[model samples]
Structures are given as C-alpha cells and as structure tokens.
Target: MIDVVAAILKQGDKILIARRKEGKSLGGYWEFPGGKIEEGESPEKSLIRELKEEMMIDIKVTEPFGENIHDYGDKKIRLIAFWGEIDSGEIVLKDHDCIEWVFPKDLHQYNFSPADVSFVEQLMK
Candidate 1:
C-alpha cells in the first residue's frame, strides 16, 4: 500500500482544495494538499513537507480526522487525513493546476480522487 498524508486546512467557513495538474495521476481531480509519506517519517512530518512542496505554504498538523484505504486499478492508497493550520508562507500553486478555498456545500462540484472522497464526507459531517 502507498502511505500518504493529507491536510484538512480550513479558514473560517472555507476549506482549501487543490486541483491536480493534467497528465498527472488522477489528473483533473481535486484533493486536499498532501503527498506520500516517506519511510521513517511520521504523518505530521510528511504533511508539513507535502504542503510546502505542493502548496508552497508551511502548516502545523493537528490531530488526524480519519483514515481511509482506497484501491485504484494500479495501486492501493492508505490515506491518513489530518486537520491542520497554516503556520506561514504564501499560497502558491507550485504543483497543482489551481487552488480554491471552497465551502463544504460546494465540494461536490469538483471531481475528487476516490480515496479523497471519504475525507470530504467527513468534513461535511
């Protein structure tokens, strides 16, 4: 299984969501900004590194909201989703095609990776 971490970052009533770049895996899908967890690294550390690499922002990871295991055709992904807050830096689309701060009700408008769909459901609840 591929271990990954995702940041559930919110600013008031809106949550941050990033659009994956075309030609990438799950291209055009929207997801919480995060990346693979390296060996010997904790989920929090992975989240911090991923946010910085993908979003160009630093964040402080809080408690995990939930975890989900999803299987795509080629691989299985084990996602550890955590709630986090921005510590510093600007929001730049370093890896994603675009970024949006969307309200929970509007989340369904975008296409999301199957694994990430569960996280969004948790956010709504």
Candidate 2:
C-alpha cells in the first residue's frame, strides 16, 4: 500500500482544505492538504515537506489526528493525518485548484476524497 500524509491545518476555528486539480487523481475532490510519503521519511517530516511543496506554506505539525486505509480498485493507500498550523508564508497553491478555510460543521458540504471521509466524520462529531 502507498503511504500518504495529510495535514489538518487549523486557523482559529477553521480548517484548511484543498481541491485537487481537475483531471488529476481524485480530481475536483476536497482533501486535507498533503501527499505521499517519500522513501526514508517519517510521516511527520513528509507532511511538513508536503505542505511546503503543495501549498507553499511552512507548517508546524503538532499531533496525530487519525488514519485510514482505503482501496480504490486500482490502488490502496494508508492515509496518515495530523494536526498542524501555518508557521509562515502565504499559501500559493501549486497542486490544487482551490483552497478554503472551513469550519468543521460545514465540512460536510464539500465533496471530499473517499480516503478522507472518515476524518471528516470524526471532525464533524
């Protein structure tokens, strides 16, 4: 299974979510910003690097939030999620079509990637 990491970045009462670029894998679906973990990298470090690469923002990863493993017929992924906050830099999206800061209660309104649905349910609870 491919290992991935995602950041649930918080700013006040809002959480940051990004829309996958159209035509890409899981295109048009909203997800916690993150990417696949590279070789020889810890999940936390991978998340930090991914935030900088994908969103152009420096993040301070705080704690583990949750994880889920899902199969998409073509592939399986283990999604490791963590809590984080922006440390610096303005978000300049490089991989996403859009980004939003949404309250937990409103997260259900967006169409999220299937691998991320469990976390969304936990947050809504």
By TM-score, how accurate is candidate 2?
0.98
lDDT of 2: 0.96
Which pairs clash (backbone N, Cα, C closer than 3 Å) in model 1? Answer: none
Model 2 spans > 4 angstroms off? none
Computed on alpha carbons, the lDDT of every model, listed in order, comes to 0.89, 0.96
Over all chains combined, what TM-score does candidate 1 have?
A: 0.95
Clashing pairs in 2: none
Cα lDDT of model 2 by residue, 1-125, tens digit? 99999999999999999999998999999999999999999999999999888878899999999999999999999999999999999999888989999999999999999999999999999
Supply the global lDDT for candidate 1.
0.89
Question: Which runs in model 1 stand beyond 4 Å of their true positions?
Answer: none
| Cα lDDT tens digits for candidate 1, 1-125 | 99999998988889899999888887899999899999999999999998988878899887888899998979999999998889999998866898899999889888888999988887777
lDDT of 1 at 35: 94
Q: Residue 57 of model 2: what lDDT?
A: 88
